[model samples]
Target: MKVDYIIVGLGLAGLAFSRELEKENKSFIVFENKSQHSSKVAGGMYNPIILKRFTPVWDAENQLKIAIPFYKNMELLLGNKYDYKVDVYRLFTSIEEQNNWFAACDNPTLSSYMVPKVITDKFNGIDALFGYGKVTHTGRIDTNKLIEDYHFYLEKSNKILYQDFEYNRIDFNENKIQYKNIETSKIVFCEGFGIKKNPFFKELPMQEAKGELITIHAPELDIDFVLKSSVFIMPLGNQLFKVGATFNWKDKTSIPSKEGKEELLTKLKSILNVPFEVVEHVAGIRPTVKDRRPLVGLHKEYKNIALLNGLGTRGVMIAPTVAKELYNHIENDMLLRNEISIKRFENN
Candidate 1:
């Protein structure tokens, strides 16, 4: 079969790219190996504020502006709301930290998103660490539902091929690329950590890290917004909460570990006074780059081949803008950002 583009991996990057292509009435095919992975498992939080040092995220304002509209449009197309706009209550752990947050809020750069407020009586069994600040306009994507709905849409449109990609099956010619008997003018890889095996772009600085998360059913905690201290508690409805995510830099295994569970349990105990049941545990590797940016560009020698991976943990927030940028570059002869282009590793 012939198509305009072949997209590998059906993660958020692939989905976002395909969504854009569909918007422009372009033809494409998507290949997905697994039904679930980092994208679906992710809490899908899009926060403009970085709490660690109280600084704004890079280009957050523009990213959020593009993302909010994109997801809303998708929701309209799907006839179901899949994204949410909510606030994040970052719990403070100390009086000193509270004072520091207040000071930081006064900074013009931080004041818009950060609201100085002490959350005390919001929930039951709450230990007053220090206080909390609200991050307005923060929200999460219901990635699980989005993926399912998109998969169904693709199936209905007959645009998805569910199989493991075999590199040996791909044929490259001077003018085109073919994958498993399907010919396309260009092929883009959105394969996440799987990019490590792509001979063309393996040299790119991708620091793949493993992350583990657990689901807890805490009926006593009626928190509607995301709660964060060291770890984050995202409300998943039905008195169920998704808590997690321990980052393991050295280990890249996707299997949940006993140590991960222990870490989550320990942290959960510190924040909640109510009893909860551990329901689910999962782990996946994030396609993180060393410079903490996405890698998007065409192969120097093979102009018809491109990569659209390395979204890291912020794939939900970054994918829309980057995909739009990539689409413009491919269709209108625009330039990819030097910081995200693969040229940086050419000499290495």
Candidate 2:
């Protein structure tokens, strides 16, 4: 009943951390209740640009270097092909927007990912008015399948426990933690928005956002690239495209709202003239923080307790490196950057 680590939650964050532990040959046990769906039902797009403003995402180059290979390794380890390399076609709304894209391409940091050439609208249904700017080194991950496959792998290795983690069951010590009969050198919390219920780390501010997505059968819209406008229309093949998502800060419920579906359809119609059928609608809560950075580091009060949450809309690109940073910080006393480290929230 003893191990090197007891990890709670098995979302992208937990999975990435577990991979690191396994690579190091560290013994650990994971508790997952399958309560969250943000990572599970995510759009899984890994773009380095802020498409809304035509600017580079924070640390895009470095994050891409680490994230791409990390997921590739996961594909090899799990013996599944979930990582996809596809271009993101950013539809321009106006001449001004196209000019701004030109400006972004001039940036040395964005030059690699942003293509200066304007692509003609290949599909008649898409409203590519001023043409589109294709973003390179961008792709999508089949996160649902990745999570499912990784879970099965963990179960096969007897490293995972399928249950909810009760906060009260844990006993904290100077150098170890005990939960029931299980004792571990440390415990890490990767509980997504579920961290709100964790008493030990609830003090940290987690501004959770609710997102809704829909799958549509757009037979005529045969496109290979990810389409971005007010919302993203991603090609999932088999004449099915994943269209989503609507972000609502006030309503954090997991239920798929009628209004959410209507909003998505409204946006989809604005860009796509083709008729489509809604195949499915799903909803999930994203663990977002006010500053829009990940939360990683040891707990302020308990040294052995750590947290890895708040990945927000870009979990696919951020989780791998953040998890590795958290692991190194714990195992080697490495310093985590102030922007991402939980230490920035001193009051917590």
Candidate 3:
């Protein structure tokens, strides 16, 4: 089979790149073994602010500028509503934090997303003693539904192969990539944490952080917007909230641990005063890097192979932008920015 490209792995990065190919009428086949669960089990929030430090995310404005319309277009194409425009309410722990939020709101870039007013409105079952700061233009993408539906669409079109892509099987000397009977001009690896197993690209540093989330059915908690305190509790409709996530650096396994659940429960108690039932607990490893920027660009040795990974905790917001940059860089011979490009690690 002859195709323009063979994309390995079908997480957010893979899907975004596939969409770019489809837009340009490029034919490609995707190989996926469902090894990565980061995108599937992600919190899926596209907040522009770094909630931890009350600052804007890296390239937040441009990322959301492309991401919102990008996903909205996908919703139209896939016929599913995945984007939810939910405001994020940051629970203030102290008066200092509240002042900091107000100060962040004055930033020329952050002024758009951060609310100037501290919301004094009390929410039931939420222990916000110092009020909350509501952020605008922030929301959640039902990435689980988006991925599931997109896979169905790919399967229907016969564009996806449900199997492993062995690195040793690829023949790179033929001017084109050859894997068994298939031949392609290039290959893009969106393998998430699974990229560690890839021989050609495994030398790149990848710090996989295992994260866990719990779903709770809290009928009495009546807040529609996302509440961020000790942890973020997002509404999932029908009185269900998705609470998460604990970062464990040592655990490479995706299996939910007893320690993870207990950690979430402990944090959950600090934020909630209402009765709730734990519905589910899930875990996945996030493809993180030390510098926290995504890993993008072609391999130094293999020009035809590209990587899109290390989206970290902000995959929903970063994936679309990086995917476009990678696609443009590969297809149009465009110059890549130094920060996200894999070449930035050349000295190391």
Which has the greatest lDDT?
3
Candidate lDDT scores, in order, read 0.86, 0.91, 0.92
**Which TM-score value belongs to model 2?**
0.98
Q: Mind giving the per-residue lDDT tens digits that candidate 3 earns over 120-217?
A: 89778986778999898999999999999999999998999999999999889656888898989999999999999999778888887999999999
Question: Model 1, residue 73: displacement in angstroms?
Answer: 1.4
- Please tell me which model should have the higher lDDT, number 2 or number 3: 3
Q: How far is 179's C-alpha from truth in model 3 (Å)?
A: 0.5
Give the higher-lDDT candidate: 1 or 3: 3
How well is each residue in 124-167 modelled by candidate 1, as lDDT tens digits?
Answer: 75676566778888998988889889999999989998997777
Give the Cα-based TM-score of candidate 1 against the true structure. 0.96
Candidate 3, which segments miss by more than 4 Å at Cα? none
Candidate 2 lDDT tens digits, 19-57: 999999999999999888899989999999999998778
Each prediction's number of clashing residue pairs: 0, 0, 0
Local error of candidate 1 at residue 209 (angstroms): 1.4
Whole-model lDDT, model 1: 0.86
Stretch of 10 with least lDDT, candidate 1: 120-129
